[model samples]
Target: MSAKIAVKGLKKGFITDQGLLQVVNGISFDVADGEFVAFVGPSGCGKTTLMNIIAGFDPPDEGTVKVDGASRSGPSAKGILISQHGSVFPWLTVQQNLMFGLNGHAPSNKEQLADHYADLVGLKGFEMSYPHELSGGMLKRAELARALVVKPEILYMDEPFSALDALLSLRMRKEFLRILAEERHTVVLITHDVEEAIHLADRIFVLSARPAHIKATFAVPFEHPRRLSSPEAQGLKESILRELGV
Candidate 1:
């Protein structure tokens, strides 16, 4: 697998009322094409900062980020970032939200594509519903469908299930896995949930406290429909938790 995204010696900081507030520190990693990678770290540990730099939403004060061997300057259509709060337009119906990014396509084509993804994400009957009318889980499904409808080459998810209750989060994880199996988009996820990282990532990177950098990395070798209760999964989860100092 070749590298789809690469980061080298990344360093970022912000100006604060007190002084300079350093966030990411000398972080580096590569996410392979079609691979699902997750970053786990303490709160305020700069995981999202690192992700934002990689996604071209912000520039690193030092080091570099490259996508497909080219330097990333700004947000690219090839990638999309989804957050825990979701990004659907509250005033727009599910169908309109999904079709928002299909401006380059013909009107009929956009409708067909939006409808296809709306159904795929289990929002078939809610295409006409607005975000305010949907539940937390339904809103998440709508966000996923909206992102997928655009067929981005990479999906950057920042604690995408953090807003849901435990059971809903678990179900969404399973549903997300099923969707990924079919769409096969390269993914980079950031989460404080160790179990979520274990369940969804092909590889996990654990970061240190503030001014974060990779402290450890783990490979999850379990097959799909993984059993979190299995010895192997539990052991890996334990190792990750230990690294996180949990």
Candidate 2:
């Protein structure tokens, strides 16, 4: 498959009280079209930094990020980021939140589109509910709906389920997988959870600690609704954990 997104010699740093803090160093990778790729690493690694550059939320001090063969310098409508910090607007209802990004569409079309995605994410009856009325999982569904309602070509997720309780996180992952099966989009996820990465990604990239670079890459050979406890899955998980030095 051709690359839908490409990175080469990517480096980023920051000025701190102690002097220059290098976060990403000479990192490079490609995400194939409609592929679900995850980056797993130790805390303080540059996974999020690498994601931000690819999403056009930040610029790299060196190297390049190209989407569809074009260098990305700023955020594009074709991509949407569902950040770890959460993007739901407290003041808006689920319907309103989904409608927020449909500004270019006609009013009637926007309403229908919002309704479609809201239902798609299992928030059908919660259309008029505000963010505060929703549970952690529901809020995540709302955020997912809002992003998908825009029909972005690529969905960038950063620790999207990190805040949910363990059981809820598992449920959401299953729901997310179902949704992905129905709606195909290139997805790049950043997560510290090894099992979550294995469960959701087509390919997994493990990064080194700060001044991060790719340490290893693994292909998840299992099909969807993977059995994590199966011997093969457990073996792959062990390999990944070993790479993470867990």
Candidate 3:
């Protein structure tokens, strides 16, 4: 079943020279099953930190992170988190990395899973390719497939495409949209790129600078394969900018 994530009164903090910095201040939101939602905010706004809590890498100082209608303490099989930087092992080939999380599964099943994902991410012939040998986009694709192979009900991504070469970034975005079109998977994406968020998200949540709070939530009701330069797109961007006080 597709997973729906509901986060409430979430808060995170850390001690600094400035005293306790409460990054994500009691932020709350719900992600509908199979919906693509973008979390946009300025730097040091606790966007990533909030994502980490939902992904179960770290616990929230307060509030509840529930998945599929149940309480969650740690990372749940219901979802997979894809961080901004490439997390693929340098020592592993594209195929091998896809096998990283499938350690306990049978060998044959793992091979089947890898082969299926290789084809899914358009990396069929590059299974033996090492991370270092592939281009930036290719490496991200491998990681994407690896995350998808686990068949997570929810996918949490943290600026996964930010550092890619421009052309590669577009290709990856198209691939991302393609994957969504194939099978509906609940996805929460943390990004600062307004245009990217407009193109990929069904809804966008804007967070305030520090002690982050939900500034605004925009429902992106555009059809898929939306043109980036469309009037509607421009309007959405304008509204988001205004919300962030940019």
Candidate 4:
């Protein structure tokens, strides 16, 4: 449980007509290697903002973010951040889109890379399919494959399954969790779904309403494909809800 990723006094701001407005209010935390940790809170709670800073997509006006003891200034070889929205290039076919990210990393073995993730995400036969032709859930799976093919040390997921329907989302969640569990990739999830955070995360960091800071941290004890009806899972969710005053 060494600190693979650490955030210290992180602060971010945006310029507005009202002048500079702060978002992330010097929040701090640490993530252990091979740990699946999730950030949960209501909207405008700075969960995504803090995640962006950690991903190197957004810079903090004040504070520090380090991965493996090095300060991160941009997307690094140590990690990959999957944005909340689309990461796929619509003009490219599924294989092409997937291949685009893995290019030059493995050279002429690109097809093998494509097929590997295709199978990993259950998109084996649709490599030739275009993004526009695929459903929302499939697109997400493709993104997941793209990020994973690089074999990142840390995976930053910003509500990756929120776009799908209940059943599909559940399926995707189980599969995604299984892949990470199997791969042993350290992950930081930014989500609003308490049940989801509880189900897949080894540790959950709950944030305050806004100008966010850690309100509490909970450890989930259930195994993968954790049951929604499991007493432990249900009890954890209820505890979070009660704490959050939701």
Best TM-score among the predictions, by candidate number: 1
Each candidate's clash count: 0, 0, 0, 0
User: What does candidate 2's lDDT look like per residue over 111-201, in tens digits?
Assistant: 8999999898889999999999998889999998998988889999999999999898898899889988988999999999999999999
Q: After superposition, how far is residue 57 of candidate 4 from its true place, in Å?
A: 1.3
Which parts of model 2 have CA positions greater than 4 angstroms off? none
Order of quality (TM-score): 1, 2, 4, 3
TM-score of each: 0.98, 0.97, 0.94, 0.95
Q: In candidate 1, what residue range of length 10 has the lowest lDDT sum?
A: 83-92
Writing each residue's lDDT as its tens digit, candidate 1 over 1-246 gives 558998899999999999999999999899999999999999889988988898899999999988899898898889999975678898899999999988789999998999999999888998899899999999999998998999999999999889999999999899899999998999999999999999999999999999999999999999999999999999998899999898
lDDT of 2 at 25: 92
Pull out the clashing pairs in model 3.
Answer: none
Per-residue lDDT tens digits for candidate 3, residues 103-183, read 679998998899889889899899998988987778889889989988888889999998887678778889889988987
Ranking by lDDT: 1, 2, 3, 4
C-alpha RMSD between model 1 and the true structure: 1.0
* Candidate 2: clashing pairs of residues: none
